[model samples]
Target: MNKQFIVNLPVRQLDKSKAFFSALGFSFKAEFTNENAAFMIVVEDCIYAMLTTEPFFQSLTGKPVARATEANEVVLCLSCESREEVDSLIAKAAAAGARIPHPAEDHGFMYDQGFEDIDGHLWNLVWTESQA
Candidate 1:
């Protein structure tokens, strides 16, 4: 059987968040999406990101949602097929209103870059020589 992975994040504005990710070339699963949450398809059916309203998220976790802008919450890393793919994804993220925290890094064997989304969530895109 194929394994699936999911990550949940809190967002202030569901519509805007969906729009932002949509602009970055992501699609949502309608069956798992609604007014309070959006199931973002990160890698077809294998990987998903559940973007939930802050209130809904708080209800689920019964804790204060992290202020990702001012504090560190989590850093999500995704693997890419090539260095150019990483750069390309970053460009799309920038155009979609995400913040590019820093420039890409090359470590001979690894290349990586990251961006902060509209809700201040950090997403790292990485590529490795071994992946090629």
Candidate 2:
């Protein structure tokens, strides 16, 4: 069965968040995006990230959103085809105002790194060797 997934994140500024992600080579679905939220297409039609305004997101959850900068929330990870791709993407993210929390790590079969976006959302980029 085919399934679609969406991860919602609250951002203080919609346009700023959109620009940040766009600089990192992400595209948003115009049909689902508007003034209050942007539907970021992470993986074709299967995976997506909804960047929403604080008030709009709050209305959906009916609770106070977690302060991503001060609290440990979700860590969204994306897989890359190679170590170079992982490093390249991290560089783009940094150039787009993302904060690098640490250096990349090489663990034999995997190489990984992480960055916090403009909204303080943590994201991990990883490249893993495929076993034959």
Candidate 3:
């Protein structure tokens, strides 16, 4: 069986959040986008992130949305094709107003870097090499 993964996140402003990810080269599905939420396509049809306005998100969950800056909820990680891709993405993110929380780490076969988006969501870009 085939399955798709969708992660939902609460954002203070839908348009701002959309622009942030767009600057990183991610596109949205028009059928799934609206004023209250934007469906960001992470990997074709397999992976997607729903960036919903805080109020809209709260309406669905009936709970308070966690302030990503003040608390840790989830860290969204994406695999990169190469170390250069990882660095390039980080640069784009930073240029788009993301904050680099820490320096990139090189662990022999693996390299990774992290950034906080406009809404303070943590995201990590990683590249791994097979040691065969």
Candidate 3 Cα errors over 4 Å, as ranges: none
* Residue pairs in clash, model 1: none
Candidate 2 residue-wise lDDT, 1-132, digit = tens: 579999999999999999999998999999999999999999996999999999999999899999999997989999999999999999999999999999999998999999999989999999999981
Candidate 3 global lDDT: 0.94
TM-score of every model? Answer: 0.95, 0.97, 0.97
How many residue pairs in model 3 have overlapping backbones? 0
Deviation from native of the Cα of residue 5 in model 3, angstroms = 0.5
Per-residue alpha-carbon lDDT of candidate 1 for residues 22-129, written as tens digits (9 for 90 to 100): 988899999999999999999986999999999999999899999899898889999999999999999999998999999999998999999999999999999998
- 48: Cα error in model 1, Å: 0.4
Better of 1 and 3 by TM-score: 3
Residue pairs clashing in model 2 are none
lDDT of 1 at 17: 98
